[model samples]
Target: MTVPVSPRHDETFVLNLGPQHPATHGVLRVKLTMDGEYIVKAEPVLGYIHRMHEKLAEASTFAQFMPNTARMDYLHALAFNHGWALVVEKAAGIEVPERAEYIRVITVELNRIASHLLWWAAFLLDLGGFTPLLYAFDDREKIIDLLERITGSRLTYCYMRFGGVYNDIDDEFIKGTRDFIKRLRGRMPRLYHDLVTHNIILIKRIKDIGIISAEQCRRYGATGPVARGSGIDYDVRKHEPYSVYPEFDFDVPVFNEGDSMARYMVRMHEMEQSMRIIEQALDKLPEGPVMAKVPKVLKPGAGYYYSAVETARGSLGHRLVCNGDKNPYKLKLRSPTFSNLSLYGEVAEGMLLADALALMGSLDLVIPEIDR
Candidate 1:
């Protein structure tokens, strides 16, 4: 919802945020019934970039839909790739090798860092700070370049197959990841101190603004930092124990205050946590082929299968129904941003316009994910 000027009789009027590509992240338009600067009611209008991916899934071969997964959440595209691969593997009873699993974990964690970094940059830009974007990108470039070396493309990657990954990791990838970890680790303090923690303007703007409680998150089915920030420890990685995440030791960050600042801190802490996972993966890097042996033609004898993974945004779930065909008869994608964005109407009701914007930014939404 947007903030408009004062009206006569304290009359409530609808304010359109966007169906255009301004600061609302994507073409998200929030129709706000405003009673002179305060939102009386909030309703989000969606479907600006709806691609009907589920219908496309019915037409394409199971493997052909790999690229489509990334389109929904480009920031965490690898997680989408991994999620799709996971469901198909489960459906067909394909076993990923131990080495492939390690490679997948490492690459996914790096992608997670890149996603969080971009969100950090964009969220700061929404707060009117431009410099953070540069620093964030400087570090993020290393991850993109590293992934591109193996995945062949940078942003919307389709590097995962049903049983394993597209390519194996060489020493180049291993060393590059190690160097990047060192580089980014040294820069984390500045990110926290200079731009966030001690900045009075940011603190005053976000500290107690747009509070979302634990009850609110549970009610809304909010996950990821949006849920964790509100003291709900429901990370798919930890709670569900997907991939090699159970082997890694990292604490989920939670804040009881549940304000925009709490969300901000959660992501900042998560970046560090992601680094921990990547470091452990690199050290335990094994030797083997990345891709597993599978039938040239895939025909799963499946009724229904579901798989979930922790994307940078939250829990990304893929459900498929196969009638012993090469293509899925039914497909469902559960995007985290959609659920997180749904909470906006309730949380943003009485917040100041600027504060509401900050809270929305804190959610770190990628609109294509919501629209799809």
Candidate 2:
């Protein structure tokens, strides 16, 4: 598509990045007003994907919405699954067994690592380093196979239930997880840092670029690594403990620099923290029933309840209004990417078009979540 020069403002023109572009990752369109490759303003255009999730929840039973959770953010689907379960469980006052909580934490942390690994791969590819992309995927595939063994889906998982997970992890899953943890712990430095992070070009490309201040994060309600990268010490798993997360000891990686490199470093360190959580949970794995004894058809009492989980991208909130019915009265999802992407317009204004794309990549957006 040709972007004709504006005769009145000869140096400026409006350009559409994509409703279908590889850099946009999903069906995300951005209308940008640019002056000679420098973006004058950036406006994200959403709604390419229909949400209907809240309406669907109102029509379907509590248990039936399990699959819908995964479709929103397929990269971190299990976290969505956990958030949905937490929503119904909190509203219904369901008691999950200690063993099941541990299982959920373990699975969710593995998924988090997998999500970060994929981001690392894709982000590197965006930066024009294709070799690290292969290495990143090689590491991510191990965790993916491990998750598929128990969750039964490699991408969009429907493994979580109202009270606990739908299935119990066997010895094979345990062994696979342990082996994966060890392998990733060993290869992370050489494959990720030495190959990509420390490269001079990579450093020039990301470091001190697209700076986001802590004030900007607060203004935009950005969470996860984006906030953490800007020196905001808020993580849902820590700030509002849930599941078996409080039991685990891990550090929240923060970088005060607030640049694209800072965000990249935060995720890189987070993968280590996730593996640490996974190892600790494995060592303390309890032996009991994974599935809780809940009604076949779950009908939460009349009330309003919300649940928040720390996904790969950040805080994922699921709010529900129940009216003593099998289906919810209303459901609202607070997606982190939506809030994080909101700041893109302000941040991208003065940056070069390439750096703007880099900043977008650093946000690790799952567009369907924003569209929803």
Best candidate (score: TM-score): 2
**Where's the lowest-lDDT run of ten residues in candidate 2?**
1-10
Q: Please, what are the lDDT tens digits per residue for candidate 1 over residues 1-372?
A: 234434454577788888774569889999988776787677989999999999999999889999999999999999999999889888888998878888888999899999998998888888888888898999999999999999999999999998789899888999999999998988888775675667998898789888898898888889999888888888888887876788888888887779888988888888888888888888877788777899977898969998999998889988899999999999999999999999999988876767788888999899999988
Worst 10 residues of 1 by lDDT: 1-10
Model 1 alpha-carbon drift over 4 Å, by segment: 1-10
Tens-digit lDDT track of model 2 for 113-211? 989998988888888888988888898899889888888989999998877788999999989999988898789778778878899999999887899
Q: Which pairs clash inside model 1?
A: none
RMSD of 2: 3.1
Q: What TM-score goes with each of the models? A: 0.96, 0.97
**Candidate 2, clashing residue pairs?**
none
Reference-based lDDT, residue 295, model 2 = 83
lDDT of each: 0.87, 0.89
